[model samples]
Target: MSDCDDRALIEAAQKDPLAFGALYERYVDRIYNYIFHRVGNVYDAEDLTSRTFFRALSHLADYQDQGYPFSAWLYRIAHNLVANWHRDRSRRPVIALDEIVARSLSEQHPEVVTEARATMRLLREIIRTLDPVRQELLVLKFAEGLSNAEIGKILGRSEGAIKSLYHRTLLQLREEMEKRERGER
Candidate 1:
């Protein structure tokens, strides 16, 4: 949608709370998918998505058009919530590998799930080590499953620049993971 289109929608929504439904409908799925990828769980993703929209709806009148897409505003909200979620999650005590294996021994089919979860957790750790821009690009591209053009638009970068950054980010992540595997931090 064009900036004009979003401006109209925003104005309408500002006038009537019911009109906000249109904006919500337009962006909910994308927001949900973005949150899901960040949190890696349906329950928290759904909750955080709801919170993101709730904050957006309440602050509708305060929103100013800074020449950015409406979706960008929603994404900022989602990103903040996700960051908070990660911060909160980090404070919880972590289970040791032995404890996890002991617990998994009781499950009938834990092998695949355990392995997949381990891989994703390791990948998340590696991603967290990246610079903020690269992390955002990875999440927008892989987590939200957006195209390079879409990511470029959201990030305010040229498509060619996004492609170059993505390539470099992937190379760095591969090198980091390999080093990690070789008992190097």
Candidate 2:
């Protein structure tokens, strides 16, 4: 895990407010990106990301180290919040990395703008077509770099089960990609 063990940070934060800032600094971008990718918009993503952290902060005292790691717990919270948002809004949202990359490209470097835009568009379409669970798995595994065991912890399954599911999900994604390519051809 990252050296910013949330458990330790939370513990310290209970005593010192400054410690919580460190935690926020460490996780804010990730939480934002995660939500943005899932919801496909800036407003909802920002709201959900803030709510996730707020809930975490409010429930910090209830947190315990189950040896599963802290990110899992935070992700679980974020996932539940997003699910609730979906339920309440009665909408299935899709977050496109293309939007994010485009914003960055516009702000910083214009040279690679074309390449980044194309890649992000393809990536966003592929991600949008994935089953919701597969999309979450990819976010956790590839984007967050969490292990299968950690994914299981976040997802409430066993490590073996998570590994099996990930394999199956990858196969499904490959088949879908191939089918899309064939159709394009």
Cα RMSD for candidates in order: 5.7, 4.0
69-131 per-residue lDDT for model 1 (tens digits): 788889888888877887888732121233444465556467766775676566677876777
TM-score of each: 0.70, 0.77
Return the TM-score for candidate 1, rounded to 2 decimals.
Answer: 0.70
lDDT of 2 by residue, 1-185 (tens): 35356667778987776677777887888777777767878999989999999898888778777776677777888999888887898766766566557777896667689877865666567767777787887888887777888788888889899899899887876776677657762
For candidate 2, the TM-score is 0.77
What pairs collide in candidate 2?
40-95
Total clashes in model 1, counting residue pairs 3 or more apart in sequence or in different chains: 0
lDDT score for residue 174 of model 2: 70
46 Cα displacement, candidate 1 (Å): 0.9
